[model samples]
Target: MWWGHPLVAVLTVWTRSAWGFSNGRVGVACGDMGPQHGPRPRPDPPPYSLSVDKPSFSPGEPVTVSLQALNGSFFRGFLIEARDSEDLQSPAVGVFSLSAPQQSQLLQCRSAVSHRTGSRKTHIQAVWRSDRNPPHSVQFLVTVVQDYQVYWVRITGPLVVLRGATESPSTAPPASPSSPAVLSAPFSSEGCGLTKSCLREPEGCRPDSDHRCVFLSFTADASGRSVMFELSGPAEGYVSFALSLDKWMGNDDVFLCVKDGGGVSIRAGYVSGRTQPELHPQESLWGGAWRLENGLIQCRFHRNSVLPPSFSFNHSLFVFLACGGAHGGSVLKHQEQPVVSGRQTVISGPPEDLRGSRPPLLIRLHGVLMLTAWMWTASCGVLAARHCKHLWSSRSRPGHTLWFQLHRTLMVLALVLTAVGFTLPFLYRRGWISCQRRDCDHEAQAGCRTGFLLAGSMQDSYSERDTHLTGPHIYGLPARQHTHLELPLKFQDTTLPDEMLVKIQITFLVKLLENSSFVMPPLLCVCPVSFSSVRVCVGLRSDGDVTHTHRLHSE
Candidate 1:
């Protein structure tokens, strides 16, 4: 049974008396529909199986169908019919007869599937009938995938669709107008490409008259759940694709690969939370499949693994493409993140539509304030150290000590500046920290210990002074053996606020059996000058005898 259109093909299997003609019908076997004049004889079943090379076929691609018929002696004549899944009428049909009934034979046919404007799934059915058996049919389904497509976005230019580049090439040459491009080193954040809407390029992608470019063409196999990327650039180097989960540098999840002209490829992955993306040393990530042919590097990876496990197809992803040109012949020069000298492109896919959005306003303000306060504190401290000497000078330098008046003024000015600078951060968060130290060991046998005051709270906790620092560590005492200094301190108040009222007491224990004179180092104190005032007191005791007392203040 032949259809008038050349595109229609039907396979028909018939016997001498049984002419099976089944068309445009459903759930009806071909043998039952044969021209029936009277009751016919039933034949033995044919020993054969029908199979196709591949389960699916794209439009215009040919499918190879084979039927292996064994013990041909059981059948003196036979016929087979192949029909389209949608329109069963007018199928391309073929028939054959066994001259010598003792041999086995194979039946094969090749046909092309017509291209449809839209993607569709359909099947082709093959039915066989013989002298000894009823009509037997088998069906196979195939999906006709549409051709590949590409959208190009130039750095410093508008996003444009390159219509002619849909034909995927095996390899890329140095220059091709139709090639999808990466477009220069140190790729800026200004431009990228996607399969969907084409958005305008940002200001950062504006070209500065000198830029290099790269091109990429890709196709997806939906049945296999994989995508193939074909890359061509100036270098015979390597290529990589990165999925930035947060659209930020130093945090991209990337897949890197290298392929030689011989079609051998090696790959690596920088996944999980790897800040510095590098190929995994122990595992090869090219489990899917890849090749380099005709100067074009082709790579395929599973769609499910393109992003981190934390992200799904529904979540937006920042996609990046990069190429490492060959330096000479032995070593490949690849670009690091922020690709200074290399070219790159950033494309966004799914969910969020925009790339490279600015940070929130409050975050910017907090950074500026903290930086300014730190700078002010450092400058004031340096100036005070260079000019003020009254704070550290002793009575031995009587003549030079006359400069105390000028020194005190500079010292006070520095304190006021430092206090203001140091208080800004605390003011922003209403928190500050203070420390007090005491050495209670009278014979200098115990090691040094430290304490702390928790910021922004009245409660305090102290750790046991277990660590030893007694290796003759005489920090502010006269240089002599068997001579020691003991200091004890207590804090009466613990609250810290804009105006913290702090009450502190100190005791000094000095043992001087060989030396008569004792000296006390100047104590430094600072408080938030914006609230009120600050004061410091020092008492000197020698050989178990009270000697001198001094009080310092600045309001």
Candidate 2:
């Protein structure tokens, strides 16, 4: 009962104990060592007491513990643990082994005994061995269940002493100098880039001036033997930073300023991969202080600059800043991308300004390339091929038309840049990233279709022999021709003469046709220019005689 709920809690109740709840065996009930027995007797004193076989013990030594009924009565279930006599609120600190295995079970609290079955028993025996980091003294606490309704919680037992410890059960726990302290004044950026290595979001924001700033700063002492670190950010849960060897997040030294109730807890941890960082005991710290005000969490502490062999005073490392939700004392995954420094910074090196961005370098590059291709290069190329063709008609390039050469070069460059820009995001993310701008299934499929359409328009403008355009839709063609020119084309395998080709092949750019036979002047197309007439006539000159005449019209 003294030991509270640790991480990953689960409660198992059998039969009537599972009333009004599903899952007879696995149900979400209690977080602490107490049973979810509901209404209370104000915790009636249990008719049992804990007894130990020894009065004093050393570290890693076993001591037999017994939970026996004082009134010769039996209990249906029980939970037992050894808690520090000094800090009764902390968790248990040892491993347990049962001597009577049939009547008891070990729980997620591996250092204690819980019920295996609800069968009644008068006594339970076990052995609890102290770990290396044991307290000076301990006292056993048991929660015993009489049948089901009558159970007592946190029933205190005899105090066990550690051999030769100066502590007595009656003596109060000493005041710790490293106990969580408080800060009244807010943090500042007055000495940044001059005496301390500082990293702040928005580049040069001062924490004292801007409450929205997420800041971290470290300053080495005159002797360079230790460093003082400060962190300030607005979070309901926590704000943290990690010192990574590279841009990635694994195998890094991490620290956190967790907001708990009205105060904060400074934590030291290390990351193994992309996993939750494993927390370590904090004891080497000094001058630790924290403040919580106006939705902002701030903390500062001091530690030796020389950590282990892997980390030193002058090692270059990237710093990452992230903030996210947390429940109780466990942290949650970050909600958005974290800020990462553009380059590494040495903690003990000369103080200087630092710059960083939330998005990765590759993602930023994708945006620049795509904007240039879509907004500037592609649009200019389309205009040049349409209106500027006549400007360069007199010049020629090697074996190709000068206007066609310029148009092809510009469009081709646009296509190449678009392709490279789209591919970089996939390379950085290791997969296709969906466009969040709209509710599309994916980004790759949409981008590919757009690229194909752009390429098709550019290709069809140059290729005179493409079969799709030869279907008599001549006005849409990007070309020019005058009357009395050799058109060099045939209809139904019969060659049309030059003069007839001009009259029927297409309407002139700025001229109406002369009086024609069976003209259809009323046909109107939705385009920049209107058609005066559309007609075709062919003569089969076999044996130099007009054998037959054929006519076609848009009537």
Candidate 3:
């Protein structure tokens, strides 16, 4: 064993060197038989080396420091820690473990620690130990850079109303000094007492004083847009108001007003409505104009209408005014002044001044509806006429009685509906009456006269009404003077012109044939005749000696 020991030592040393651990310690010994106790090989000391990269971070920003261990024998784990200048020996700011395959660790600094001049620093170190060796450590410094920016928010328009006796917690009062009552005078002055005291009462007129009083209060957002408002009456009554930011106002600016029967009272600006009476008492009115000035919106309401009042007997004066304006911002102030009685009340606000017109699509749709109704009525009349004949011919067949009854019923219905439909256009055109006065009497009397004439003409002159014809001429002579005439059948006088006389003869023939079904001819086979042509020929003959001969042909 002693003889080969030196060779074993040499081989072990070669193996250690090949593995890059040649400097590490190894033991050796020699036997007496071989050169007895030769010098023992000295233990090679463990190698140790460390490398660190520069730290990178912004002020108030998080940073990570890393240290690399190299040329170390019997390698162990590493330690990482950091601290700011505020403490000389603070607890390790952070600690991390090191592992194989490029071992590394991370440490985080508290966000509160800002990077000031020499105020922030990060320290990193790696700890490792070899077998039977004292622990060794490597460290690196981390410099922190200061980087920061300032931020803030700005608000435009009036500040929010914090508190006041009369002021609304949510909105600011309108800055306008004039009351709406004064602005809408004359028309508004006629019915109610103009005296200052009377105007203050809920009824709009104080019995003892002349001043009228109305109060309105509401909230608004940062943009001076109306949030909401409440109106109180002298009696047990009140009202609320709101509007949206987007609405169309035409040439006449929209305004809200409280008026007596004669249109005398206080008023507010233009508002929106979801339903009748310009006030959507059921839904909260939102996103409408409250006031207009200098082309800017002073206030904007919520996007919905108010809910209906819970109690039926409760009286509320809520009203809405929609005016015209496109791209108006929000409501900023009430242009009208307040009326004061016992308490300050908003009488009226700035009138909603809108800028644009309505779309053309709505007008076109209305016209289409009117035309469709007219065409439908005419078609119904023609269809009834055609179907009535079939039912009349089949009346004798079994089960045909129902069809005949239905046909008769439908014919009457169609006739009545067609008459109403035909009259509508004439009425709209104001052709049903010739009267020009706007008074109720004139209108009623004209309507009565039109109704009477229509009823009489329908009953007594059915043939003339249906055929568009006229009456007879003198001594059965065909007078060629009259061109277009429509007359009732009750007149037996034969002094009418030739065209009128021919129409009467044809009407008489038609009635005679209809009354005597037994002797009736096939009138449908007669075909349509052009009376205009026949009249032209007759008129030519009446002209002085024209001598134009015309042949009459029948098919």
**TM agreement with the true structure for every prediction:** 0.26, 0.46, 0.22
Best-matching candidate per lDDT = 2
lDDT of 1 by residue, 433-463 (tens): 2423231221111101111121121113211
Q: Between 2 and 3, whose lDDT is larger?
A: 2
Which prediction has more favorable lDDT, 1 or 2?
A: 2
- Give stretches of model 2 more than 4 Å off: 1-179, 260-263, 282-287, 325-337, 349-361, 389-401, 427-555
lDDT of 2 by residue, 307-328 (tens): 4312455679898998887889
Candidate 2 TM-score, C-alpha based: 0.46
After superposing candidate 1 on the true structure, give the runs of residues whose Cα lies further than 4 Å from its correct spot: 1-209, 212-239, 247-253, 257-270, 273-314, 319-375, 388-555
How does each model score on lDDT? 0.31, 0.64, 0.27
Worst 10 residues of 3 by lDDT: 148-157
Task: State how far residue 343 of model 3 sits from its true place (Å).
Answer: 32
